[model samples]
Target: MKIYADNAATTKMSPAAVQVMIRCMEEDYGNPSSLYTIGQKAKETLELAREDVAAVINASPREIYFTSGGSEADNQALLTAAQIGKKKGKMHIISSAFEHHAILHTLQRLEKDGFEVTLLDVHEDGLVRPEELEAAIREDTCLVTIMYANNEIGTIQPIAEIGAICRAHQVLFHTDAVQAVGHLPIDVEAENIDMLSASGHKFHGPKGAGFLYVKKGIPVTNLIEGGAQERGKRAGTENVPAIAAMTEALKEAVANLEANTKRQLEIRNRLIEGILEIPHTALNGDAVKRLPGNANFCFEGIEGESLLLLLDDKGISASSGSACTSGSLDPSHVLLAIGRVHDVAHGSLRLSMDAATTDEEVEYLIQSVKEVVEYLRGFSPIWRDLMNGKKEFIL
Candidate 1:
């Protein structure tokens, strides 16, 4: 069937984005930093793209800073907040335990440099508690960075509530909204977000394109130093073509968000229902609070790696967890954080649908998964032991 179900990893660029990219590359091929007529046209395209991207999140064009992608944006956001906090004598940061590696690894580096980080527990539902986050803030806490939506388990955090609490406490709030930006509606001002990060490829835009949103008066510093591009905060020849394509993609996504959400939700819920019909299977996150196209499950008595390989052989593309960490041999940290033990966590499957996914495709996926799990379990010694009651079933 050649089903590609891993939309959380990335998506195919839309035709509108491709056309905009081609137009920019072919006709508007001038440096936005140059001071000539051609360059002026390119610069105009860049600024208009900035405005379009800003409008998607209800942000001002001046507040948006282009970047290579989500990782750079995340690093810059953290660096900016940490530097600002350092000057103000605050060195503590708060985040959730299940955040993407971009945020988690940066927090680790910051910890080495004398910043205290508190990663609140995401309970079995994979949702952070707003009260706990509010209680974690202190006089020394300067930033509370949480992801708007999880990349693996697909849990959508209570960003509005968390942002309100951070604002009440006079702390800066940042969210890595890489997975939520185009899929979900975001209003940075209304959400009280002080800083935000987004990537392009997550929503049918080309990769290597993204932007960081910093509320005015937050003083952004250069993550790279050179020319005075990106308001002197990001120094490089601006990628005008990528930026324009990304902006077009964002605008299209926002325009069709309601209809796409409705369609994907139906497929996602059906996938969940069909998959859970298997014995000893369980969903990983809050069903209703997750992204419309995401469904993660842990099937007892099978290995995730083998499941993926077999599914691939069946012409279906899927993942056990985050694509960024797919090479690792260890089980997913996000699944573990949600209280899944190692055995169950190792048997996980993540099927992320998209607007193109159809009900027939989802039905094929359900049947294929059922057959694969049953076949894998037939020869697994672990399954044998569980069936014989030598080892207890977790899921």
Candidate 2:
């Protein structure tokens, strides 16, 4: 049986979402920018979508700006914040080392352009301490950007506490909630977040559709310059169909968030418990503070790539790190930032489930992982030496 456990990277588009998208593509194919009757219908659909997305985060419809995806939204947040706050002599931006590259690389580019960046370190459990974040804020710090939950390790940061600190410092706060939106509850108002980013695909919606929430009155420069679209904040013709489908998907995902969270927590715990029962295996993130659907761990004396290939052969899909950076040979920066040594980092695996995941599937994965780890460890000289209590073998 095929088991898909990589929901953190992206989920299969829900049937409901697909149906809505198809209807829009076939019947409602009109430019929202046009003033014709069909265009008016499309524009209405788009407006309703905005309301749905806004409802999920408890933000007003006008505060949300649709973007191509999470990357663009993140870029818009950082660049806009930095640009608007430049004249205030507060060019420094603070973020954790475990942020998605969307935030990390953008901050790196800003640094190259003479902006100061403070990359706060994460604890061994892959969590950034709120106190550490508060300490990192400075007079020249324009914005504080952090992820709601890590994509690889599944560690949920203390975003509410961090946001409160930023509020007290009077600094703009942004969070890349790409992984946290549908998986967990988020209230921009309660968290005091000035800006937030999320991707549709992350929550079973179509790809290439996302939104950025910018609190009203926060001045941000437009990332794209063109004819007035997205109220002149984002450029190009709005993708009405994808936006509508995304709204439906978001509503469905969040409607039963409590039930889904409970189910995922049960499945995730079973998977983690099963994996920990295996020898020489260790969990990679905080047990209590993580996404309910995420389970990341490392198997000593085995390579993550090898394990992934084995699992794939068994019809199980998984990942070693962020799907965006999985092709690179270098280890994940997020893993390294959490103080994992190269060897442990190299052996890491991330297994994230979703609302559709089943108990049988989890059991199958647990069994498959056990067999693969045993098979791999049998060939490892380190395992053999340790088993024999012989540690003096010279290379």
Candidate 3:
């Protein structure tokens, strides 16, 4: 049925967001940097957008710094934290092993810059223990960065608990909430978060737009030194159209988040239940402590690429761990971090739904997955022996 089940990676932009972008392109195209009337109107619109984004996270508009996307926001947050830390002789940063590449690679670069990093491990269900983070905090630890929700397995971290720990330690706390925004509730003040990152595309907003929230009074060096924009925190001309669209999308997405969450949970549960009915299958993450729309599973005796291709043939769009790491023959770091072995991790598939997903589509996906897994396993010698109840011995 041509179903698209990769909402975790990105979702189709909502019609309201597109309408706002169209209006901005057609009428509000003036440069916000200029001093003319048109520029003033554009500037006002940008400020309103900032307020909308801030309201979504319960932060002041002055704290919001728009960026190109989630990756840039993540880089800015981590780098800014490191810079602030250096001023106080605090150079150590702590993050979980299951964070997105945006955070993981940023920390890797910080390591090259001679900063110490501690990558905490996740449990088998893809959850980092709050105590582990509390234990990781130290006198020289400047920042504790954790993801609000996992991109692959759909596990939601205890962000409030972790943030409280960082607050108690008087250390800065940052969360990559790209996947969590629009799907879950977030209050920076209530969570005691010092910084947060989010992307537009993750929440049905336009791509090429995002924002980083830096709490008031946090000292951060400018990442881009150019025309004074975003209160001298971010530089370059503002993208009025995209930013406007992002604000509209965030408002709409967060307005009915509770209802959307209930619907998504229904679809995810149905999909997971159907998949578990298939023999030799296992779910990849925590059943209860996960995002509403995430349903990841692993099938024995089948390569994830083969399964994805077969599903594609059935007009069902989905994702595979191996497909995401197509060039690298390595399994997903998140899966491995959550205690999955390389072989099992290679057979994983991530099926994320959205508010637009239908029950029939979920059913179709479940049936398609069953046929594909059975077809792939049928050809395996291991399956043949197991079916025949044959004896086996291995070194």
Instruction: Give one clash count per candidate, in the order shown.
Output: 0, 0, 0
> What ranking emerges by lDDT with the best candidate at the front?
1, 2, 3
Question: Over the stretch 1-395, how does candidate 3's per-residue lDDT look in tens digits?
Answer: 89998888788999999999999988889999889989988999999999989998999998999999899999999999999888889999999998889999999999999899999999988899999889888899999999999999989999999988999999999999999988899999999999999999988999999999999999766789988898888889999999999889899989989899999989999999999998878898899999999999977666878888899999977887423355566778888898877666777889989867887888888899998999988797656765776823110
For model 3, what is the C-alpha lDDT against the true structure? Answer: 0.88
Who wins the lDDT comparison?
Answer: 1
Return the lDDT, model 1, position 69.
95
Which residue pairs in candidate 1 collide?
none
Q: Candidate 1 or 3, higher TM-score? A: 1
* Residue range 1-395, candidate 1, lDDT tens digits: 98999989999999999999999999999998889989999999999999988888889999999999999999999989999999999999999899999999999999999999999999999999999998899999989999999999999999999999999999999999999999999999999999999999999999999999999999997789999999899999999999999999999999999999999999999999999999999999999999999999999999999999999999999999999999798999999898999999999999999988877899999999999999999999999999999999988
TM-score between candidate 1 and the true structure: 0.99
lDDT of 3 at 39: 91
Tens digits of per-residue lDDT for model 2 on 1-395? Answer: 99999999999998999999999999789999889989988999999899989999999999999999899999999998999778788889999888999999999999998899999999988898899888888888999999999999889999899989999999999999999998899999999999999999999999999999999998767989998988888889999889988888899999879999999999999999999998778888899899999999887777888899999999999999999988787888888898877766777889999867888888999999999989988898766776787753211
Cα error, candidate 2, residue 217 (Å): 0.3
What C-alpha lDDT, on a 0 to 100 scale, does residue 68 get in candidate 1?
A: 95
